[model samples]
Target: MKTDKPRVAIQGIRASFHEEAAFRYFGENIETIECNSFKQTFEALKNKEADYVVMAIENSIAGSILPNYSLMMGYSYPVVGEVYVPIQLHLMALPGVRFDDVKYVTSHPIAIRQCIDFFDEYPHLKIVESNDTAACAKRIRDEQLTDTVAIANTLAAQLYGLDVLERRIESNKLNFTRFLILTTHENNKKKGPANKASLCFQVNNEVGALAKVLNVFCHENVNMSKIQSMPVLGKRNEYNFYVDIEWEEAKQFDNSIRQILKYTHNFNILGEYQQYIEDDSPKPQTKPDNTKRYITVKKIE
Candidate 1:
């Protein structure tokens, strides 16, 4: 079936996790614009080359990607929506290659860190870092490296014609990454109903200045989901506070934002969009058969 699809810019190759998140958010029909870096993903949107961008903001196992927060502030791109993708790292290699034959393991630094416990069991294997997980798998397949293994998602193994030597190799089985759907200012002007918002501000350099701002949100009955402080560049004793707040009543959020502005400096509303709610229970895991040409992974509940 052919249909017009929105072009979504993602910070990795086609089979990377970012692309998976984009598929989950925009449906499988959407077109993807691959960008080498997160900054480049935003550049695609800025240059009108892509309609939207899917960028990872944080990982459950690795904490937040602080550089992305800076990019959000620098570009001022509006976050229209969000999605959470499970980070399931798999050990993949050339067809018929066994785990015993693997000599080197390579993947993105973040992916390698998550699977540190799994790799600890194999001390003989040399660990290497790559720019992207899917790219690592592609390299192994293209070069037919029998001694090399790639730590990546199941999609990578399927797309690159590699076999999964080990599944769910990440140290934390519950790992998941949250991604933000970003669009240009004009495109986001009529954004859908928003129950959550991300705000960035700096408090006065005085005692109780920050607390006063928190008190305002409390008074308005708004729920603060996250609060992170980043040091201000070229300024001493100053920091930028990034906050995520959720609200049931729109007026409460509006009232709180109005009150907060009076208590902070350089206040900026980074985004206002629907919050991504994760499923409560874990989903059943299914092992892929070797004969299957393409393996499809179910979304984590």
Candidate 2:
């Protein structure tokens, strides 16, 4: 009943962004179980088919995935860690197939939408919507469709043996998606020291009720990285506030949680794990010189 590698469930197939996120969090040595939907990922974990679930929670351009928030609250799985994946889309086709030979482009609806600006220049190519971006590339390889192109990532291009005709075709190059690592076990030894925590609680509708909790966190010097509110099902005028907080010292976060409990109800700690911080250092600016010629020189053997 024991396997050598951990089976991580992802919302999409291998070579998709979800699988890439999993590879980022857990090393590439692990096994990935593909799921059709976010809910199915949770079910896989619950059914013992997978050891972990990598689910996307938000995106830089498209915004939060509201349904995932609902799924998290419904399943109550502990988030062990998180990772951010840059959504770099590329146009790929069979080798030797020129852009003029392509008559159609296919990808996920969201992926297709992100590359609308690039597709606008080529109005001759018909746009097709599919459930997964990598699947489109896989189909092109399996069916040998010379007229169809797939919008996917470099991983897909390599996995499906396709050539990238166009690189970084997404409208917003800085786009990225934040994925949460969830597990059925409450404690994961692999997760390092905790600095950030995810929580969900409800406060009375009375005035200053929510402010009181925020004030507690502010007084404790705990930085609130993110906060979201979702309406309680079948309950009018009631909402659950989900918050993510970070701190310099553990005491700061601990004190804030204790003080906020007095002003909130139905408080729940979803997860407490180390926060992944991205480097935001600015790069040096350079001026474009049209006078300079840039070319790759090939060396003869």
Model 2 pairs whose backbones collide: none
Give all candidates' CA lDDT scores: 0.85, 0.85
Q: After superposition, how far is residue 179 of candidate 1 from its true place, in Å?
A: 0.8
Worst 10 residues of 1 by lDDT: 292-301
Q: Where is model 2 more than 4 Å wrong at Cα? A: 278-301
**Could you give me the TM-score of model 1 versus the true structure?**
0.90
| Candidate 2 residue-wise lDDT at 300 | 16
Best by lDDT: 2
Clashes of 1: 0
Error of 2 at 184 (Å): 1.5
User: Model 1, which residues run further than 4 Å from truth?
Assistant: 1-3, 189-191, 279-301
RMSD of 2: 10.4
TM-scores vs. true structure, each candidate? 0.90, 0.90
